[model samples]
Target: MTTIARVETFLVAPRWLFVRVETDDGIVGWGEATCEGRSETVRTAVEQLSELLIGRDALRIEDHWQVLTKASFYRGGPILASAVSGLDQALWDIAGKRYGAPVHQLLGGPVRDRIRVYGWVGGDEPDEVRDQIAGRVEAGLTAVKMNASGRMSPLASVAELDAVVRRVAAAREVLGEHRDVAVDFHGRFTLANARRVAPLLEPYRPLFLEEPVVPENSHLIGELVRATTTPVSTGERLYSRQEFLPVLQAGIAVAQPDLAHAGGITEVRKIAALAEVYDVQLAPHCPLGPIALAACLQVGFATPNYLIQEQSIGIHYNLGAEVLDYCVDQQPLSFVDGYVQRLTAPGLGIEIDEQAVRAADKRGHAWRSPTFRHPDGAYAEW
Candidate 1:
């Protein structure tokens, strides 16, 4: 029997926290616990949680998840859930390596041969939007996701509303009817604004409107859902299965739980199952590094209700280092015709460049999400 040996956390460039777990027998597994701007806080949480895992059996993934999540008196939020998410991923990786199979195989085998993926396209400017999306298409990607607007007002003016429509129009024009484009509101709009904008986007036929409203306004999602013919997708801010229940009942067409923030593969698989009951599709929200994307792909390959994936290979946030920088091999994450073929490698499927991770940690960063404020000095959701 392989006993747990060491658990370590590394803060790498471009705002990502990676968890590394090794067993006494020498097998190592990696996971990403990135909680965006809160990387430092989540890193501390991973250290505290490591105390519960240091001497236990590495194969006891579920038991560890239960204790790591429930043993504490106060539980279940992005920090704790993100910490558990990374560790849980490492454990599943270990289990897969231990059994000589891929994580998807352990999760009841693959339901699809390959997973469809989408890349992020920036530039609120019309020309930038068109050029960026054209580049994605030139790369052979079939789908792309772009933000609706930047720091939008609660009640958008006609010009602001028209700009949002124009951006989507630009993306759709570049993508053509053959390819797809997803619009992300990023919780920057009020419910009324979302309701107003959702209908206008219908003609462009966006794949979906993401985070149409913030997670806190989930109860109001149904109203927006009812108002729009376009599919409403959300859930990146939501962490647990219970939190997802209300949104699922609210009639969202797609669920976009982030693997790093949504309790990793273990909880997300359950979330996929729950979403399936509501006839909703799983499109794991992954705008982080390779490990997080790998974990999302593992669940996507095994999940029947999955729609598409969001990858951050060239996202704007990746300034200091790119996703493939820490990876030893990039083939596992290579995109062919807009989809990543099934990852056949064991564990999380991609090999991490440990030396690169260590070197990056030595120069660790204190990354924070950009704060937004309305012109009148009111706090705005970024």
Candidate 2:
């Protein structure tokens, strides 16, 4: 049996943390557990997790997860959970490669054949949104998600509300009647604003309304769900099942747990099971690199109630970098009719271009969500 030898992390460009766990037999595995705006903090946490991994048995992933998580009394937040998530992914990669099987196969095989996916359109603007939606449709995507509004006041003006409505209206027109459109509020709206905006976007019939209210005030989610015909979706900001219980019970139409932030495969699998019990759909939130997306696809393939995937390929964040840039074999992620076919390759089913990853690591950039401000000096959400 090969024991774990070294655990190394790379702070690569576009704000990603790639971890590679190498074993005594020279077998190597890769994992990406990036917490968007806080890559450095996650990197430090992964380093701490390495202490528990070095020289330990590589196959005992579940045991290591328990120790790295519960053994430390205080646990299960973004930093700690994300750190554990990355390590869990690496272990799964190692195990799957050793056995020459995909991660989904280890998880009782795939429950479904193909996984449906979605992409982002509008950013902070109400204008140009229709054009963006049309562009996504042209790129072979059947569904698209757009930011509803950005940094509105606690009680936004009627005109501001109207602008939000108009953007949704335009997207609906571009998508016609059959295609899907989901609106993401991005936790930018206050409860009062969300209540108003939710009803307004109803006519467009969004596939879901994401984070209409801030995640902490998820109790308000039930109200938002009741107010709009659109499905209420949130959970990307949430880290664990406990954080998601109330929202799930509130009868959300979709549960969007980001695999990278929600404690990786182990924790996200738990989250998906919880969502299943509540009869809510699972759509793993993924706006990171290819590894995170591949991990999401593996989980989505095994999950029964998966709704649709949110991928970052050609997204605004990718800017200079594309999703296929890091993968050695990008065919598995190729979407036909906005769905990625089953992942048949071993581990996460996508190869990491070590040279590209390493070279990009040398030019790692400090990525920050652009600071926003209202007309007044008050800070705005990005």
Candidate 3:
């Protein structure tokens, strides 16, 4: 049996975390955990979880996931689930490498030759929406996503409603009707405000309005979805299929499970199939690094109802390091026009530049998302 010899975590730049697993036979696998703004916390979680996995047979990916996920008396929150997610991905990486095939081939077979992907365009205010989208279009991207609004109040006024619609309109003008654009609500809006804003953006025809309300209130997402003519997208905060099932049944039109957060290739594929039963589109949320993106791509290629993928190439959060900065051969992971071509290489497909990862790990990061407050000093969603 190929037993896992060592498991290591690297806290890299721009708030991304990576995991490296090595077997007794000298086979290595890489995976991205990338719990943004909490890299150190997740690093500790990875180390703690590694103690449970180090001596286990590397090929028992499913059994390991069951143990890692359910062994805890209490399980399935972001930190623990995200830790299991990266380890699960690394195990799949090892399994693929051992068999000399990419992960998609190992999971039944590929349903498509290539996967379509989207880039980011960020601005707290809507003024930069048009020019930023134009830049992405000029760079050969056919799709882009932007935050739907800045810090919104529980009860938004008429001006706030118009502002959100205006941003989508600007992107729609740039993208036209044929191309695609997605709007991430970032869970910043209250239920009333989110429902009110959703219909107003329908004229612009966004591919989806993501996470209109926080996942804590996911029971209400169905009400928000039915309240809108546009498709609702969410699931970055959701950690498992149990968490996802209710939202899918809640009538979300698109499911946006992050591979790094939702138990990696193993759980996301299951989530995709569950969504297909509801006729919901699969768009794995991956605004992280290359390994996470590669894992998302493998699932995308095999998923029949996959919509489009979200990548962090040139995204605003990538301050010190970029997506391809840690890649050995960037071309294999490079976007052609808009889609990432199907990866034929064994394992996760991207050759992680170990030296770059190590050097960046040394530098590390103390990244945190900004906090917001209303005028009355009450907390506001960021």
TM-scores for candidates 1 onward, in order: 0.99, 0.97, 0.98
Worst 10 residues of 1 by lDDT: 311-320
For candidate 1, lDDT tens digit of each residue in 17-110?
9999999999999999999889899999999999999989999888998999999899999999999999999999999999999999999999
lDDT of 3 at 40: 85
Best by TM-score: 1
Count the clashes in each prediction. Answer: 0, 0, 0
Q: lDDT per model, in order?
A: 0.93, 0.87, 0.89
Of the pair 1 and 2, which is ahead by lDDT? 1
* Cα lDDT of model 2 by residue, 100-159, tens digit: 999999988888999889999964554588778888898889999998887788899998
Question: Which segments of model 2 are wrong by more than 4 Å?
Answer: 123-127
Root-mean-square deviation of candidate 3: 1.1
lDDT of 3 by residue, 97-156 (tens): 999999999988899988888898976555598889888888778999988888888999
